[model samples]
Target: MNAKKHSTLDHALDNYSTADFLLSDHFVNHQLEPTPETALLWETWLAGNPPNRHEWDRAVYLLESIRLGLSHYAGQVISEEAIEALLARIRETNRQYSVPVRSIGRVRWMAAAVVLVLSGLLAYWWHGRHDSESYYAERMAGLQSKYTERVNRSRAVETIVLSDSSVVRLAPGSRISFNPSWDGASRVVYLSGEADFEVTRDIRKPFLVYANEVVTRVLGTQFTVRAFDAEGKVLVNVKSGQVSVSKDDVPEKGNVQDASGLLLLPNQQAVFSRRSEEFSKSIVSEPRVIGVENEMPSFEYDAVPVTRVIGDLEKAYGISILYNREQLKNCELSASLKTETFEEKLRVICTTINADYQKLDGQVVIHGGECR
Candidate 1:
């Protein structure tokens, strides 16, 4: 690819969020439903470099609100024709959906807060291990020698230093099976699930990943591998560097050339089908978004308005937001969610709004008539 294109791709990949991946998945599944107006808004918002946090939160809030509203109003009973018309008017004017609210007591709030904080720390520690190349390389080699032990739910997270210094964070629920006595020119591992890899550069010892019939070769790079057993499809998302992906024959004919793979650059993805023995590549953005750079403000609130707090909850958790009283939007809420459950989080928000939460048909609804 040209330098300009490569640069643009890198920027998009590094700053990718869960929403972008969802959007791509829509296209991949052939379920794209974006209207021209929505597309234009997305383009305009994404064109800006590192968009403002408040505006970014608002955009996510609006999109989710609309999505939820559509789902709710699709099949609901209304009193009179005028009430139906009024509902339509409200929907058109709001252009957003109200997220369902679930109640949580003080105890639940405390427990959830603890989990969230600890999860963040664990994620950070995993990244630190990936930064040390030598550590992970040795660990990787040791694990390869011990492959094929056939242990159920045998989970291990290792940060190995490759021959060169680079880091890779392997997520949980990943397993590898290989020969203990195997020492070939190429370093290889058989993947059964998902794992993130940060490889060190050594033109001599190329890193090879085997997922079912597909093989991914990389000299040095950071990427993720997802081999779904149910669907029998494999995916590789490259964060940096380059990789060559291909398919091979079944184990019965050891090491037979099945089909040639495709070369992928940074911010690109490759998908392979075991049955069809076909691989396709396309551009993909990164997976994480909020709090990525530490430059954006954290989800901290101190007596903040209820509407703004609800907006934050929707962005952080990727869920629907709802409210019955418009006056509650101005109610003040002071709470932290560094650790909390969905129920607890809602209670905190509800407490400030002085409202009650109810669940109706798997959806939460806030029904108090007064606020403040």
Candidate 2:
């Protein structure tokens, strides 16, 4: 590759850090077209970056594995374009025909593809043959050699305190493994199930949790992660502080602009669907008062204009409540809601005002006609 071409390819590869992007139709069609130029581009790019070679190799392994599996099924080797088209067709078939694809055991690189091919015409016979938990166990086997592993086999939640005084509450059937020494630039833990974490404040070393295909990063925060191996979704719910959630496969190369993910604040949650390779942000089911207990504001209202009432609620919970100020200008609410939950308060207020509220994109939006 020429210098200009190499530089362009390098810039593009830096952004294509996630395996999902690499496996997408755009990447397959343009970069893996079996042309000599494409081959040279990848060869030069891979040879230039020794540290990221493993990422390239892993993507290649997944692509070839999918190709070989499809070839074995069709009795002929398929081209990259053909593979992309077939995968798209399979996804559409799944949506149209409701043909469920089971997850594979060893590698979840291209989970949908691997499972669809291995199932062979959507057979239910392979349902219980391989366990997804084994895949997680095998993936963490290498780290287990150097990390401390904690499993909560009991019915109750288990409490674990890390070396940095970070607390982790592992739910039943959950497991977490981490380095005890805390010598790295970041505090990392591998999780396979559900856990609530209260990380100690450390601006220098951000805390990272690897849960299935999703990764949750925080400087210091309280959050819950539910990522069971057999489940199709990974959830990160922030209770306090901020979190950056993204696909675990995305490589961090010291460029903030190159990163693609969701930034979650208190009471915000992110859901990652393994099948769609998508992330969705929303408000948590239950939102609590945001500030310190002693400085908490009262939720009492005395025939106050509905706008002021909503403003108080927004300040108390640190959530956005949307409503037209002009329409609700004549509305008044009188209630002592200090004991009520977040949703309960909204329900009570909406009921009194003959209004209804809907959650949209992590905010509560009220819709109602102007009161007389």
Among the numbered candidates, top TM-score falls to 2
lDDT for each residue of candidate 1 in 1-372, tens digit (9 for 90 to 100): 211222112334335433332222221122124554544344333433333334333333333333323333344533346444643543332222111111224433343344334334433433344322322233345452455532225356655433345454444555555443345665665665677888777776667777655677887887888863333357888776678787744432233234466877665678775434568664453322222345433557787777776676555433345675466755776777656655567767766666766532223466673554
TM-score for model 2? 0.63
For candidate 1, what is the TM-score?
A: 0.37
Superposed on all Cα atoms, the candidates' RMSDs to the truth, in angstroms, are: 20.9, 16.2
Evaluated at residue 224, the lDDT of candidate 2 is 98
What value does the lDDT take at residue 55 in candidate 1?
38
Compute the lDDT of residue 241 as modeled in candidate 2. 89
Model 2 poorest 10 in a row by lDDT: 97-106
